[model samples]
Target chain A: MDELTAELTDLYNEHYSQLLRMAVLLVDDRSAAEDIVQDAFVRVFDSRARLRDRDRALAFLRRSVLNKSRSLLRRRQVSRKYQHRLVQREPGPDESAHGVDRTVLAEAIARLPPRQREAIVLRYYADFSEAYTAKIMKVTPGAVKAYCSRGVTRLSSLLRERV
Target chain B: MTELDTAAPRENSDERLLREGLHTLVRDVEPSPTALSRVLAKRRGRSGSRLVLGLTGVAAAATAALLLVLVLVPDRSPRPVPVGIAPDSYVVRLADGTLASAALETGEVLREFGRVDAEVTALAKGDEHVYAAVAGEGVLRVGPDGTTRRVRGVGRRAEVSAMSAANGRLAVAGGNRVTLVSGNSTRRITLDTGLVVRDLALDRSGRLALVVRDRDGGAPTLRLVPAGRAGSDRIRLFEPACAPLRIAWSSTGLLVLRPRDCAARDAVRLTTIDPRTGGRIGGGVGIRFEGPIGGAGDVRVSTDSADRVLVSTATGKTWLVDGGGVELVAEHCVVGRNCTPVPAAM
Candidate 1:
């Protein structure tokens, strides 16, 4: 009804999925990421009338998603460690997954530096451009290139060792 | 030199094996519908709130309000010729009989950007050349005279992920590398593992781009390699959580990145940043999500001019957008749609 409410609504409409996608990549949990983005919208709505521009509001949401995602990663990592320790302590049949012809090459990829891993994921997983990627990661295009080049070289070496 | 090249061939063989091995290991790992639906549901709730705003007051007020909100609200958000201005734009349509390209000015049939082909997966346009990726093959190039060239590489197994061309040079994404082919000269930049290249873009300066996935261990990187001999440089673009999948470059060296919803298995968000610095451009670049519009499958970002892009969302919708946001070019676009002529914004 009010200009501020209408604006916040449009901002949510325009950016909800994009924000959630970012949240998913960060959190790795579909349901939680959705909640994170929803919470972001709620934040935007709560500040509706005071917002100066829509672009600013959207940026705020993206930054929020990025922050929330980091926390999610920390949580996922902690749980993963607990699960690993549990498996090691219990010695269950699940341990056989270790022998299941784990693709060494995939493991090498998974072993890349986190920066390189992210670059590879964007370039390969979702398919994006360096400039665009730089935007998402908040870096320069050249830096993005360096990460990929070095990352690929490392991967190549790892793959070679497998052979 | 000679020794490296000799060893390079052996390494190439290994690389090929690795590629095959990687594909085999990960090909089946597509996003699940359940994941996609969950995200889509969230988007609907968010987007629906705004779409519903068309409800109350005067049409003009609501429309203006919507436009402002859409433009300024951020995220997820082209064209042409004449000495410096394009008088007629291209739009493909399945009119009466076959596919046709209708001129915006004359409303007459110009040649179709050609052949129906097997479901074109990607498309790009440069100064005088147009490129499209046929579902199964590499990129197909169409010159100004309508001549076609199907670019080929050493391996037939690599799929063309995305493409960009300008200044007589064309760059294509094959597997994890971005290959630049000019005449017969070919140079390839292979991407790092765990990184999936979603798109390729080239700035006017002949800079090459590889847009990769975003992961959390560290910041996701956007690799900008110069087209010249100096080669690659790694720049941290955004934090790993960004998860950019689709990318485009404007002539001005502005880069457009779109976040993808792996859950919905769709191109969900788009962002524009400085290609060189990776900072948010002062003026906003448009990133429009077209999926919820009409079963829009995959969103493709192609250069409309050096400055703007034409986003064809899976819904058969195309928007002529600038850095600001999605400017409604045409709504309800059908599949196999030809490039439509967009009028200069008033």
Candidate 2:
């Protein structure tokens, strides 16, 4: 194994699961999240020369996953607008009755405006600090706080009746 | 409050529930075991596929050359009647980022203008100079001898979306703002806050035709405004079903290139509209493409003094439209990739 490949393998083994879970929380689609995470790894490998440091590589992977998820959502919105139909995946047989509340909460999170959802995911799911989340989102920390507050308020109201 | 409050308040019940909910939402999610192997496999496959594509591209180029000769040589069809400012050549930014002026019919590069460090977002040509909008770097005016200089007064970091130049005048649209430049006097016109300019055109008489869409996304609308005027003087030209890809002012009227259906982009056509009343002039000519063209910067349309229209896609495919007929004239790829060519003014 070459030096770059060895470095990539180590990064992949350490951070791939966490990034994949983060993407799943952001996009709410398992297959799409997998694709996003895999593509982010491939892109990081392609640009590995610039990201020789482990910390920078991990940061790049997180940013790439977030950006790709945003692009997928934007494309999905455009497709939905033109198709004039909402697409929902049918629940599998293994989903228990307790999964219903989780589904409701997931739907509410998905309904939050894109930035707010991103903020909520980064803050609550990834558990990044406000400054770090703001750095990744390329916004001010105050903006991150605002988005999370607004998102939580909306999500709370949305779940009051169902969850 | 400071930027970072490390000792934040403890989570309330709602916050705890939200956090728990977010965690449980993806509790069953896990990365595929073969994920890293898949990425490596794709990386390896890309390099191998490039070699195969390179060979196929050579064969395709030879076949296309033969077809071009066969189509242009023995045809008995009537020659197109050239109207308006019949320009003989056009300018193209190659994949290597260099600008070159090329012959319209032969696809011959006449002169090589130097490359710009920044990407060229838009291109236009007036009688005396060729104007290129370099992203984040305002616009540059290239003289006849290929000398280039940045035009002053336009914002240094202007993200120019579309540009048109004619009769010693230039109209540049960035965001919802349009800047009209004539001589040394420059006037900036601001449209509604939420409007995003997609494309704009300039007539010989200095009138401006703009295509703009809502920032929130919808079918783009055409608008006509006089030069050096504000949005209040704008007249809304109808909303198009399929988004208008490109618009050009011709001697006959305003020409718009649009896909036949909103959902299907492969079937594109050019329609002539009355500049005054915004009505279609006849059924319009269908532009056949070998493949579906990409969006926005992928397709470009320009017209000459003789009303001859040139359509070029980023794929390096050039089509000539004249007298209600479309002909594929050239297909020249740059660096094994697609290239977009913008026709210059005569």
Candidate 3:
């Protein structure tokens, strides 16, 4: 098989499900998130001419997915505002959590500042090495280390305090 | 408290709690697997069919052209107005997005009617005039017979993006502000919006509404404020589970909302909301559609007094649905602005 196809196949096999989950966390909309990941994949597939380095394909996909998530969020904001004007409405009820523990995690993650939440997701949930996380986030490895350190520290302390 | 390095907390501890919560949410939130496979299958089938149809059509057309050449016909000068075709006003959109009109009766006669310096992002028709907004340059007003003038020094260049004309006034929203431009005066309304203004609409009564999104990229807030009045009581209408595909407002108690999943081709869905309550007005509260736009062009949506929606796409096709089921209706090319007359004939 050609290098791009092989690389795409490998990356898809390894990260497809995880990426969908991550998108859900970021957008708070599960269907939108899944769609975002699929779009990221299509974008990567379409970039056959530019992605010559097979090793960097995974990193490219991760970055593209994050960007797509941002765009989706932008559009979601617009839709919500439009809906509010028409209905004179209120924020909908919080989606019920699956389990008690899961609810706690979801609340904590949701409360996190955008950057810190992103750091936590990339470092822990995605299980990327610090170097890989740095590349995906477009930050220095030291910065990635610091984000992970601070994120984990805060997460642990918050959970501990809750207990 | 000396921090104990006991990593595994109780089953109800935060780590386990968070993991469980995330897992459940993920499981509950996945897109339909069938939706994905269905999109792929449809795309492949359509492409294959198109290839075969295209080749056969090309060969048949070529043969027809050859026969026509063999049987030469008399060449007559084209007539100005073709018989039975109604004479209509035409706007030749310039590269800079200006609206210039010409007499359609004069054999497709093209003319530069007006000069709008900026991109004409949106166009709306009024009772006696046509309005075009040049995003920043302000609105251009034109008469039915090609007389044009600018509503000069009314709206700020930096704030205006799109405009909708209602009640003989043009409502524009941009830069955390909304303005009503009339004649030679501007009435400005400042909003405490936490999000950037993306688009705006106006109802028949001139009440204004728009969609704005926060910088953090959450679901956008739709705000409704009194037309030309700022700092009014703004409320949150609905939080779309996905970004909107299209949004339009109608005069008679109808709000059209099309919440589209941005990723897959099957993600385009339509929702119609009650303009006053922001609730799904008809059949069911949770409005959803199964069809996707999938690179469709010339998408046009219109609503009626009964809140029935007609979605027209580029292929000269129309669909009839009661704000939910998009049932196909008719097929025709988008003729131009004058194609549909305002105030449906009784």
Using lDDT as the measure, the top candidate is 2
lDDT of 2 at B311: 81
Using Cα atoms, each model's DockQ against the true complex is 0.04, 0.21, 0.10
List residue ranges in candidate 3 displaced over 4 A: A1-163, B1-118, B153-156, B232-246, B260-267, B283-346
What tens digits encode model 2's per-residue C-alpha lDDT throughout B19-129?
877776677777777888997787667657767987999999999999999888776999944322114556777767767666654555656666766777778866666
Model 1 quality (TM-score):
0.42
TM-score of each: 0.42, 0.48, 0.38
Chain A of model 1, TM-score against the native? 0.56
Against the unseen true structure, what C-alpha lDDT does each candidate score? 0.52, 0.73, 0.52
Candidate 3 residue lDDT tens string, B1-346: 1111233433335444445555655565544666445334444465577779989999999999999888988568786432111113223344444344333222122344455555554455454556665566576776645566776644536555445665567766566776777666778776655666655666666677666666566655566766546655444445445544334564333344444544544434555465557665333222223455443223434343223444444333444443222333332312242222111100
The deviation in Å at residue B68 for candidate 1 is 59
Q: What TM-score applies to chain A of candidate 3?
A: 0.71
Candidate ranking under lDDT, highest first, comes to 2, 3, 1
Ranking of all predicted structures according to TM-score, beginning with the best and ending with the worst: 2, 1, 3
Question: Each candidate's root-mean-square deviation in Å?
Answer: 22.9, 20.0, 21.3
